[model samples]
Target: MKHWRGAVALTISSALVTGPAVQVRANPTAVPAVAVCVASVGCVVTVVAIAGVTYWVLSNNGQELRIPVLSYTPTPDQQLEDWEDYVWADNEQQARRKCNLLAEQYTNQGGSLVTVVRVRRASQRGSRWACTFRG
Candidate 1:
């Protein structure tokens, strides 16, 4: 708008300079009619320009930019809950079978069977299996 203001100033300066009523004012007491007409026209133009600028500014001020919302769903591995389950098998063969069954269960629940080992139960007479899983 600096260029626009320059144009406005140029217009007003030209109007003041070119107004023929200045030459008609040969007597000191005479009022120049053409100069009043030019000045009034320039004032009207300035008022209109100011009004146009105010309208443009006000019309653009309230415009708002809206960004879309984003949503994410986790993968099966990430969706899996924490591991906290067990399996008990009496013999080695049964322990292996139970371990496989537990592995299947873990996979169904979105988990990975990381480790399974035989451990002796302190209060029991036989050996048992301990399984660990992760997701």
Candidate 2:
């Protein structure tokens, strides 16, 4: 009786371990549907994430215009101090509009005599050059 029980257990365990192997051997080209679907979804998500990052890196989304302002001091010995204001916009016109808004805000806040020296547009590769304000 003991030998018979051991033989039965061995047969069941071997069948359980080799069942999938036998099926693969019978039809080697058959792929499971669930694996294919999961793989396809993973690939799609990866491709979309890569494309979005590439677009953001290659585009001029975060480009800014640097406006240099010379502030005059109201003291016995008047001094002129220079500062920069950065505005992010799509183009030069939009940047000028934003700069005008900033100038209004600054003037309303009791700021000193501020005069804009020039507008500098920063390139995507970090170089900056003078850009004319059309506003």
Candidate 3:
């Protein structure tokens, strides 16, 4: 009886010492949903902003004019909400030539011309722009 008890104790000890193990299987298509979600949110926000601005411009201006909207992706070094005009040509002749016709039309209407030239360099980051005029 004592021998039998000793054998049972040894078996239990060995089982306890070995411990239980778990295996985790990897999912092959486990792409992080965070980026997708954030991008979707950004797109929605961009659309809403564009729509709201369009409505405001139409309501405020007696004459509706064409407005250009530019959109691009951001670079790694840039923060999410950071936005700025990255380039402009200071050459007076070139600037005037490029914007000459528009300036003339607005000036003819007894409104002063305000020229805003903005340029952005190569980037993989995301951004958007809208331009409108009212007097």
Candidate 4:
């Protein structure tokens, strides 16, 4: 049985090694020029899209943003006077730090009880009143 198996394996291996040469032929149908052009354009567009997305991600990451800080103090006549200022910083923490410094400076300049009323993005400053006296 072992001899028979060895013989069969040898025969199969030899047959495989001496098999007829298989010829591979290119497709007889020619690819349309328009299809080729379209494929090229698609690849270019994909590359461009990937590059654009990468650029947007890197450029916006840790980018300094314009933050609007609204500080207010009470006037002598008991009216709340508001002041809008822009803080350019990378994040909210930095903006808050800068705002605190500004508050200290404002207080030192004889402003009474400077309070940060609002800290928001500059984009949300639509139709917002600035330096106004609010009661």
Candidate 5:
């Protein structure tokens, strides 16, 4: 039984070694790299290209932006409470920092002391924080 199995194994090995070359069809066009890239890398590349093109279009047209700061100074005796337009910063922390600076400046200029009532981010390339001041 062992001898028969060994003989069968030997015959199979010899046949495979001596067989005609077997060609693998990775893709219809036979470009292996293209096929692999399309399957894996191409999707990411396509997404990035689309994003770049979108950014370019918006940047060239100056459309990717928020109108920014509806009214610079709140009316006398009225602290600007309506948010969404005043704050322009990348994050809340930065917005707070900027708001504090503006408050200090507003006070230093002989104006009544002001406080940061609200902070909002502008819609443009996306880093402006509009800080609303209140006394």
Candidate 6:
């Protein structure tokens, strides 16, 4: 009788453990309504934030840049009158140095034009002088 009782208890416990753990049900219509309300609120907040940012940006706009007035006339300091005139100095180092100096001289003499103009010789003789400007 004791062995029969133990076997019955084991069978009951095994049945309980193997039973369905989750209760499945049909989808509710109210869930969609709640999601729509939350989504609408989110959209409204997003629009208000965008409008506020745009207003702030427009209200605090920066000053416009004015054209620089040059105090001194622009002039080339170094002159090369040979085949090397057509070739640019080996790297950018020389060109940058010249540009900085030219820009300084221009700003010093009330010259509003703070620009550097590079003049290069053409491949052929009497060709129009090739020029480039940097600011």
Top lDDT prediction, candidate number: 5
> Looking at candidate 5, what is the lDDT of residue 100?
84
Q: Write the per-residue lDDT of candidate 6 for residues 2-121, one digit (tens) a residue.
A: 111112111112222234321212111223432232244232100011211210001112322121111122245522121112223433555455545656664577444454456554
lDDT of 5 at 123: 60
Instruction: Give the local distance difference test score of model 2.
Output: 0.34
lDDT of 4 by residue, 36-114 (tens): 3223422111001121121001112334222111222334476555577766665666666666666666766765656
Q: Candidate 5, residues 1-135: lDDT per residue as tens digits?
A: 011111111111222223432222112112333223334422211111121121101111222321111223445565544322354566789888978887887778846666677776656567776777765
Clashes of each: 0, 0, 6, 0, 13, 11
Per-model TM-score on C-alpha atoms: 0.28, 0.33, 0.17, 0.33, 0.34, 0.21
Candidate rank order under lDDT:
5, 4, 2, 1, 6, 3
Estimate the lDDT of model 5. 0.40
How does each model score on lDDT? 0.33, 0.34, 0.27, 0.34, 0.40, 0.29
Instruction: At residue 60, give the lDDT of candidate 4.
Output: 22
Total backbone clashes of candidate 5, pairs 3 or more residues apart or in separate chains: 13
Q: What is the lDDT of candidate 4?
A: 0.34
lDDT of 3 by residue, 49-117 (tens): 232221101111234322222222234453223123222234444434434444355557755443334
Instruction: Please give, for residues 15-63, the per-residue lDDT of candidate 2 as tens digits.
Output: 2232322111111112233223223422210000121121001112343
Residue ranges of candidate 6 with Cα displaced over 4 Å: 1-88, 116-131
Give the CA lDDT, 0 to 100, for residue 107 in model 1.
66
TM-score of 5: 0.34
Worst 10 residues of 6 by lDDT: 51-60
RMSD of 5: 26.4
